[model samples]
Target: MEKVILASRNKGKLKEIQAILEKFGMETISRDDAGIPEFEVEETGTTFEENSLLKAQAILDEAHTITIADDSGLEVDALEGAPGVYSARFAGENCTFEDNNRKLLKELEGVPEEKRGAAFVSVITMLFPDGRKLVARGECRGTILTEIHGTEGFGYDPLFLPEGENRSFAEMAPEEKNRISHRARALEKLEDMIREKCSC
Candidate 1:
């Protein structure tokens, strides 16, 4: 199988990416797995596309191989799309997942369910040593629940109730979640692009 360097250290993100790419005969490995020294790539981009490309390009430069990266976050309509790019640090730098969730709930306090519309967005960028680049975006519409739901998944999963689903993302099984997540949709598009535009 073809191996690709993934410019992310989040284990949940890694599992989601791996589950999708494996079906395409591709394997993804973290920078550490490739023996690359640990380093932070500042997300200096204002948009998901920019950040995804920045990380992918950084990895490509270091490994001189196929590299993939994705930038994903929650965009709550009530918050005017706040915590989009800053989703990871929604509470504050070095905050825990619970802290971010608490902050989100606090922000949405007293907001009606009708006004709780939200969407999870993912932007995937792939870079090749031959100067080829591909970008794909995907989104899943949902609403922010009044309270935390389940214990599975990461990030904002506990507070996100995907449209048409009674349970929050955190309440769904991994296989079920992987089948319909924003990352899964983005990866599907990326797979199509790879099959059509590149040999790998």
Candidate 2:
């Protein structure tokens, strides 16, 4: 199987990516597990695509192999798409998920359901040592609930209710979420591109 280094330490994310890429005959491993030297890859980009590419290039430079990186976040329409690139640090640096969720709820206080529209966005970038690069983007439109609803997911999953669904992401199983998540959608596109290039 082809090996690819994932430029992230989040185990959940690694698992998700692994499941998606497995069928493509790709083996995904975290940067730590791949024995890559740890160096801060600062997210200085203003957009998800830029940040994803930055991280992918940083790892590709170090490992000289195919590397994948993703920049994803929850975008609340009412917030004017705020917490975009800053999603990870929305509640200040090193803040917990609860802290960020609390802040989001507070920000949308008094906002009706109709205006609570939001979307989860994922931008995945794959960079090869030979200077080839591929980028894919996916989005899941949903609404922000009045309060957190489930306990199974991380970040803002508990508060996000996808369109045509009654349960929040946190309420669904990993398989269920992966089947319809923004990351999954992005990976699906990436898979299609790969298939087209390889004529598989």
Candidate 3:
């Protein structure tokens, strides 16, 4: 089976990516598994696609392998898409997931439920050693709850109520959330691209 490197240190993200790629009969490994040293790649991009490319390229440069990277965040329509690119550091650098979620709720304070529309956006980028690149984007539209719910999921999952669902993402099982998540949608696109390349 072919091996692909996922350019991320977050275990949750790595697991999710691995699970998706497994369907293609490809084995997924992280940078650490490849014995690549950690180095910071500054996300100077103002958009998720740009950031995803930056991270994938950074790892590809070092490891010279097929690599995938993703940049995802929550964008609240009422907040004018605020904390979009800065979702990881919404509350501030070094902030925990709870801190960021807290800040989001506080910012939306007094905002009526009808006005709390938001979307989780994910951009996935794949870079091959031969200079080939593929980019895919996905979005999950929903509303941000006034308060958090569920104890599962990371980041903003607890507060994001997906359309056509009463439960937040954090309340759903991992497999259920994976089925409708922004990342999963993006990965589905990526899989199609990969199949096309292989057939050609």
Top candidate (TM-score): 2
Determine the C-alpha RMSD for candidate 2 after optimal superposition of all C-alphas. Answer: 1.8
Query: Please, what are the lDDT tens digits per residue for candidate 3 over residues 49-158?
Result: 99999999999888898899999999999999988999999999999999999999999999998999999999999888877888989898999998989988889999
- Model 2 residue runs over 4 Å out of place are 19-25, 198-200
- Quick one: how many clashes does candidate 1 have? 0
lDDT tens digits by residue: candidate 2, 1-200:
88999999989878877877788888999999899996989889999999999999999988988899999998999999977888878999999999999999999999999999999999999887776778989999999999999999799999999999999999999889888999989988888777676432
Residue-level lDDT tens digits of model 1 in 1-200: 98888888878777767876787788988888988778889999988899999999888888998888989899999999979999999999999999999999999999999999999999999888888999999999999999999999999999999999999999999889988899889988987887798764
- Position 74, candidate 1: lDDT: 90
Candidate 2's displacement at residue 8, Å, is 1.6
Model 1 misplaced regions, further than 4 Å: 10-27
- Pairs of colliding residues, candidate 3: none
Distance from true position, residue 33, model 3, in Å? 1.5
Give the poorly placed runs of model 3, Cα more than 4 Å off. Answer: 19-25
For candidate 2, which ten residues in a row score worst on lDDT? 191-200
Error of 3 at 96 (Å): 1.8
- What TM value does model 3 have? 0.91
Please list the C-alpha lDDT of all candidates, in the order they appear. 0.90, 0.90, 0.90
